[model samples]
Target: MKLAYIVALAAGLAAVAPASAETLLRIGYPGTGLDDRPFGYGDYIAIGHVKQLVEAEFKDQPDVKVTWTFFRGAGPALNESLAAGQLDFAAGLGDLPAIVGRSRGLATEFLASAGSHDPLYLAVPPNSSIHSVEDLRDHKVAQFRGTNLQIATDRVLEAHGLSEKNIRFVSLDSNAATAALVSGNVDASFGGSEYLDLAKHGVVKIIYSTKNDNPTLGRNSGLYVTADFEKAHPDYTAKVVEAFVKAAHFGADEANRQDVFEIWAKSGLPAESFATDFKDERLAHRLSPVVDDYIVARYKDQAERAKAYGLIKKDVDIDSWFNTKYLKQALTDQKLEHYWPTFDAKGQKLTDGEVEQTRAATN
Candidate 1:
């Protein structure tokens, strides 16, 4: 009865209908194992959760239906989809990709970060000479041009007194670069923590990770959507945002960590360490809904450092990229205005575990 009622409510949420609004949302899921299609088992579950929550919240209306589009990774392919006007909500992207899309007039906006943690893992082939972040001074390093890795790689270089010209900056996608590193085609490769599984399996070793010294460089993965898309489908956008905000809570809790980890593990990752490595001390406190002032301040810092490091165009303004209306609306509607740690820290974790009170309206 509950499921049927909920399903009926989310019927026509696209434009708003008597029953519900009808929406055609094209979401990009990182295609991996479990679901050969981008909407794998986990993603399908997330989408279903979004649908259920939205439906449950607005049961009075029942006519919104969602469509989806999936991608392999966060690079050229996803960018192409955004350019073609076929995407509404996409996650797991980096700041570099966000910058390039905007530079090319992609009409996209950066929503709240998925969770602040975009550490660049500097990897080198085992049995090679480079053992420290500074060891690659005279050697060439590869990066995914116009991606988030570029910003991180550039920052590391600038801090070490090395520039792009000092060592070759080969532009390649994640797989290509990983392949290059494996075949000794490049001295080092810059990738995200998502690649940690590769390191665990001895595919490569992390000589320097963004987590090494600079903690702030590892901000949350970018969450964004096209401006036109947002405007065209505000309710759909609202629902999508709500799903992610809630998932942050679900993904962080110790009890639910395994479920989320299983989702990540299916993509060739280990569940335990992936959960452990993501459990940050301070930043985890301001995970969803309420965007801590520090998180915003950090974005400013990263943007400045990235420009100084020559990873992004100086003209890109970080402040202008974010839109908090949806986040605000999601929190207000759900009544989740309080701070919740994105991860669990044992006894210190929230009790009752409800991040905030989200009661329905009283008659």
Candidate 2:
């Protein structure tokens, strides 16, 4: 009986082994930590990922197979995969790395903003003498380079009348940075809300956070799809964006605040950490998926700054890189045109009247 069952199983495997008619859709995201956590947070994509919305969208198509990949090396690793033509789409990519990749001639289109105004936290050893941003001068600081965090760190330093030259910048990823901080090997490290859990345990003290500071000092990340995939499968592209837009609506609803955090907790971050990081901020502000004027301007500024900082060799034409047709169509189809507020180039919220006018004009 065992031998017969084995033979049947083998036959079944062989039947599906030749999947010549299958279409594989590959999605990539930069993952942090040494454990290579299979999830992510701080955006509507987290909610979408946890809910498996993308998979559900294509469930009826038996020929389609969707796969998600998380790289432990972070944004740079995502770029490497893109260069190798491995990913069809990449969500939750930071502005800086995206710009670097585009400058390097990666043929892609910015689909939608995944999350914006994500605060940056500067952590120091407990009982350290650093009292403010100015105190960072001449101190050994650990920062994750080639990611969105790098630009935010530079913006914060510039705000405090300091630059990268003012401190000893040590390049380290999240896990290494945390380990160095705990061992007193680095005076401070700039990172995301994951540090809050450490602060809760008295493992590190947060000296500065940009949650309530200048919004521009905060980081922005978004979704992107390769031009090749988008051109080849426009229908799949539309369906994927619509799925994410649906998830964004759910995440942005005030009534779903607790539910949103619970979903994000799947990323291995405590729910309370997200709660603390977004304490005063509204979900609608952070979770909007629209590629609005402010987001475009921010990308332009990031590109110019990246060029000035020698992070990229040449200019990236932001206007030509963004393709918002899918996002617009998704919003219109979902009847969510005016659901989220729009901000100006300076990050100030537009008045209701202005928002209405913009919506009308777009329609």
Per-model C-alpha lDDT, please?
A: 0.60, 0.88
Per-residue lDDT over 35-123 for candidate 2, one digit per residue giving the tens place of the 0 to 100 score: 66788887888788889999999999979898999887788999999999999998999999999999999999999998888889999
Candidate 1, residues 20-85: lDDT per residue as tens digits?
Answer: 436555666433332243433222234333334434544544555555555555455678888887
Error of 2 at 87 (Å): 0.2
Best-performing candidate as measured by lDDT: 2
Q: Return the TM-score for each candidate structure.
A: 0.73, 0.91
| lDDT of candidate model 1 versus the reference | 0.60
Off by over 4 Å in 2: 1-20, 351-363
